[model samples]
Target: MRLAKYLSHCGVCSRRQASRLIEAAEVTVNGHPANHIDHVTEADHILVSGQLVEGPAPKQLYMYHKPVGIDCKLRPDDPSSLSHYLPPGERVYPIGRLDKDSHGLLLLTNDGELCNRLIHPKHHQEKEYRVVVDRPFDAQFCDRMSAGVPVDGVITQACRVEPVAADTFTIVLRQGLNRQIRKMARYCGYRVVDLYRVRIANLKLDPQVLPAGHFQPIAMTELKLEEEEK
Candidate 1:
């Protein structure tokens, strides 16, 4: 794997952070300053900031029910950051982001490859959400949202939108644009009152079992990503 990917797989930091470390000359491979393009094998020795970096550790995944106000970014000094809620001694990072204003299922994992796979736009990973609008909307609203809505000068991909109530609907999206659901609703002349993610791929959030602000370890088998087409 590339040097950055190797560092990420070792749970040292994210691939992007790893790149910065390499650029700052904090990483070394076989006693030489590491290059970003360098690849590693079992025979190579690697170190970060003078600490030997062993091969990747066992991967771990967690299903966290992120609260509405908690920031997804890992900020040790920030009490409201996701780092405050993570398990002690584990260096896992959130797979994708759920904005602080919205809350629901969020996956945290130490497996860098899996994280990249799930969040990459080409994967078309399905994410489902339950949204409540400020005012009642009709079938036309759903049709407009399902067909597509322009966001930031780009048209969003077709998605599944189903109205559950006069002012509430469920939507499934393959794209993960920034605050996408909210933007779509606003474009259709409806303001979102509340938004909650319900599912990501095969993983579903059961509020009763894993209530808000709680999390639990999830097995790799539970994801079943192999069944998904690339």
Candidate 2:
């Protein structure tokens, strides 16, 4: 039987957390609450949330250039979306989310394993963006953001904020928090005029490539890096 190790291999969670989930009765075997923490092999039927646990899907990956005024992500309340913007195929979820008001490079994939690995807090995938604010940039604001900014009672992770123009900067983050740049700008007394993600890991969107509402297949090299992260 495949043990909880299989879950870790699938990047569902770290091995330690996987064991805890197993013990906490969050797993199932043949539609029954699977109480055992051992033997997670394929010999036994295993699932989490009614979905098969270890089998792989036909991995599909794409890079979508999200444009401003268009939400690249799916939301129940938002009446429009980029889902209709993608080429026809199996459904894919964003590897990490970008605010609808902000546009940039977004990765969509059906590989849940890589998605789990990339989004998991510990993996620390680097997300880089180009930000334009209405007000002039200040050195002090960059310093504060790089150190840490208090938001929602939690200090955000250290970031690499580099000035690209008098009114623009490149913000690189290891942590993907919801509307983090917008919140950071507000805290810094700047109005975010335009924002776009330029890079995720080694996958860089080509210069002015893939216009808004359009997507293209991603390279296998990028997928390999995500799969191997511990």
Candidate 3:
């Protein structure tokens, strides 16, 4: 593959952006500097500028219950931070993100391809959240959220919203839009008292063992599903 294409596939950036970085003389191949948009092989030593251009690391997956107040960054700028609270060593990024104020089950991984597939707008993987609101819940509101609310320019996909209590509801969504739940609630004039994501596809929090601000390794076999009928 061309060096720029290789960089793009590795989640570095797009081919054009890679070319710009290369032309800026910030990229290198092996120990030597690189300046041209040449084809590069897996065996070739490549780098952006002085840093070595090794391929992205092998994919890794973990489940973490992110507590409120922590930003979803691999390297947080805050000295007193929750990511800093993670075990030291290899860098892992969140597969998707949960807003800083929300708490829930979050997946952390280095697998860019899997991350892209799960988060890319098309798949619409299912996610479940337990939400607490400031006032009593309404069946009508639940119906509207399930029926899809128009926000921005598009309508939300029809979803599953069931009341679990007088003041809370369990919402299952297949979309990952930014602050989507909050936006939908705003449309209905509900103030969320608490928001916690409880499920992602085949994985759900262990009600018996899981807790906030901790993590557990996930088995690859669970995710290694064979291709099947769509």
Candidate 4:
């Protein structure tokens, strides 16, 4: 496995962070400073910051209801980072991201391969959100949004949009553009007052089960995933 993937499987950090650690000369393989981002073996001894890492840790996944104001990055040095909320010493990376101002169901996992597959837009994983706008939205807004909306110089793929209230609505999107829903609303002349995610893929957020800022383990068997053919 690559050094970064090995570090991630060891529950030490994400692949990106692992690369940074390697570039800073904080990692060593077999008692020698490691410089390459690739090439690591299960038999090779690994060390980070002068501490030995035994081997890959057990794979785990959790569904977390992230809170607003928490940056969705894994920076232990930053107190406000979302990774700080995870169990102490259990390093996991968010599959995608939610900006600091938006909160909802965020997936965390140590399985780097699964994380990559889930976030790839080609999978067309459905993400549902509850939105509140500053002003009342008519049926026309839902129609336009469901048809398609221009954002970031491209036409957004058609999504399911339904009005919940005069100022509230629900939307499901498969594309994870940067601040997508907010940008779509803005283009339609509406200002979003609040946005919360409620679902991702097959996982649905049950507030009574896991409230905001809380998380729980999810079984792989619960999700029927197709294994890629070699």
User: Top model by lDDT, which number?
Assistant: 1
What is the C-alpha local distance difference test score of each model? 0.90, 0.73, 0.76, 0.84
Which tens-of-lDDT digit does each residue in 128-192 have in candidate 2?
89999998878998898788887777899988999978999998887877788888888888889
TM-score per candidate, in order? 0.88, 0.73, 0.79, 0.84
Q: Model 3: residues >4 Å from true position, as ranges?
A: 2-39, 45-51, 80-83, 224-230
Query: Is candidate 2 or 3 superior in TM-score?
Result: 3
Which pairs of residues collide in model 2? 1-40, 1-41, 2-40, 2-41, 2-42, 3-40, 3-41
Tens-digit lDDT track of model 4 for 83-148: 679855676778899989998899888876677566666677788999999999789999998898
Per-residue lDDT of candidate 3, residues 65-111 (tens digit): 88898887544678535568664564556777888889988887655
Model 2 worst lDDT run, 10 consecutive residues: 221-230
TM-score winner between 1 and 2, please give it.
1
lDDT, candidate 1, at 36:
90
- Find the number of clashing residue pairs for candidate 4: 0
The runs of at least 3 residues in candidate 4 whose Cα sits more than 4 Å from the true structure, single-residue gaps closed, are 11-37, 47-53, 224-230
Error of 2 at 145 (Å): 1.7
Least accurate 10 contiguous residues by lDDT in model 1: 221-230
Model 3, residue pairs in steric clash: 26-48, 26-49, 27-48, 27-49, 30-45, 46-53
In lDDT terms, how accurate is model 1? 0.90
Q: Rank the candidates by lDDT, best first.
A: 1, 4, 3, 2
Provide the global lDDT of candidate 3 against the true structure.
Answer: 0.76
| lDDT of the structure predicted as candidate 4 | 0.84
